[model samples]
Target: MNRFEDKIAIVTGAASGIGRATADRLRSEGGTVVGIDRDPVDDVDMAIQLDLLDLGAIAPTVAQIVDAYGRIDVLCNVAGIGHFARDEDETPEAWNRVIGVNLTGTYFMSQACLPHLLESQGNIVNTASTAGTNAQAWSSAYSASKGGVIALTQTMAITNGRSGIRVNCIAPGGVETPIGEQFTPPEDVDLTLMAGMLPYHRPAQPPELASAFAFLASDDASYCNGIVLRVDGGTMA
Candidate 1:
């Protein structure tokens, strides 16, 4: 239970939802969690106001954490956005925003944190979605970005596993989070196209997803690199 005792962690989107729960869980288990989000994060050990879309701010943010905590043992790239629309309704701006935050931001955060993680032989737990592995209509941008996250997770695991860094991702089905508000389907969208995306069970709570994140980041998953562990209640099975 105290797998993170004396460890330091960085969790993006820690202001709310799964990120907030993950931060709380890790800190409860004895990790010093540095919460990052554009919004205020008062719950974690340390809070940093950061917008992941501002890629240039990432390194400085990581530097600040290192200066304060000395080292980072885990990096949870949990921040992301989603936009839903029919193909014709999808605008370039929406597409870019989704991909930029979900994919590009995750990459840069990993880049900024890798050296510290390597020094600590730490790991990364990313938040990918079932939509990434399974096609979901009206979620083109979200799917593409999460798919990129899965690929990025695997590539990082392969590139760093021998060096003692493990990278894994969780493909969640549906979680009770405010992010759903951002992806309201277009009024004319076909209902049947998305009906299959529903979970067999009710959507998970934020704490449920946090448990999985905790497991992957803990030493107990020493051999779980490059794995996409689906937390979707058999939705994809």
Candidate 2:
């Protein structure tokens, strides 16, 4: 059970949802977790308050991690934003916000972490979404961002595989989270975006997705570089 025993990990969006669950799962499995979030988080070995969109702050935060831990074994890019908006309803700011955090943030965070990761021969786990693989109805920005994540994950895996670093992505379908509490998409959007496009009628729990993340990041998946693991409960099948 302690696959990550004594290892060091960085998980973004650890304040809630899939990121929170990932941090918890890694800690429970005996990893030293440094959680990054715009808000505060509990139950992590270290918590760093950070907004992923603030690209200027990224290098310093990664440097702090290296200074504190000496090395990093895992990087989980899970911080992201999502909402339902039609193409016409999507303003320039609205489009920028989602893509900024979900795509740009992930890329820069990985960029900042790569030097250390290369030194440690570590791996990365990025959170993509089923929306990226298929039509996600009204949430065009979320889908596009996730699709970019898939591409980025693959590119990193290919680029770093020779350096003994593995990179993979996880594509989750609809999941229950704090965001669900206020999720009222535009009336014209398909309701399935809130539910899921699968026989399993309920949204997945954050922990369910977190488990897959752990597997991908662990030594058990040493051969899984560049793989896009879909934890979608058959939504894409």
Candidate 3:
């Protein structure tokens, strides 16, 4: 349980859901976690309120981490925004917002943390989504952004593999989280058909997916790199 003892981790989107779960798990396992998110959240060693879409804040934030922890052993790029816009209604702003936070934000965060990770020869885990591999109605922007994340993960793995830094991604299906709740169908939407379409007939819990992130970020997955581990509860199967 103390697998991460003495390790220092940085988790984005740590204000809630899977990010929160991962932060808590890491802390419980004896790691010092620095949580980053736009919204305010309690229960972390250090909580920084900053919008991931703002590239200007990334370097300073990473610098702050290095100043405090001296090194970052794990970086979890989990900050993201979802979209459910109709095809014609999708604006450039919407597309940019999703891609900015999900893809670009991941890139900046990784780039900022790479130096410290290189010093420690640590790992990076990105939170992709089933939408990256599978199609989702009304979520083209979100899907494309996540797909970019997967691609980035692979590129990082190949480029950093020899450097002793592992990079991997998690593609999660529908999970019970604040974001998931936002995507839930309205009262007019029929649940019967939706339930029938999914293999699990329900969404996954945040902790269930958090455990996967824990493994991917830990030494147990030392050989895992450039791979997208799906945590969809058979929904993608």
Worst 10 contiguous positions by lDDT, candidate 2 = 192-201
TM-score of 2: 0.94
The local lDDT score (0 to 100) that residue 64 gets in candidate 1 is: 92
Error of 1 at 124 (Å): 0.5
Model 3 pairs whose backbones collide? none
The order of the candidates by TM-score, greatest first, is 1, 2, 3
In model 1, pairs of residues that clash are none
Per-residue error (Å), model 1, residue 96: 0.9
Which regions of candidate 2 are displaced past 4 Å? 181-183, 188-199
Better candidate number, 1 or 2, judged by TM-score: 1
On a 0 to 100 scale, what is the lDDT of residue 71 in model 2?
94
TM-score of each: 0.98, 0.94, 0.93
Candidate 2, residues 93-173, lDDT tens digits: the string is 988988999999999999999988898888999999887888767778888998999999999999889999999999987
What C-alpha lDDT, on a 0 to 100 scale, does residue 76 get in candidate 3?
93
Residue-level lDDT of model 1, residues 35-91, one tens digit each, is: 999899987889999988898999999999999989999999999887888887889
Q: Model 1, which residues run further than 4 Å from truth?
A: none
RMSD of every candidate to native, in Å, equals 0.8, 1.8, 2.3
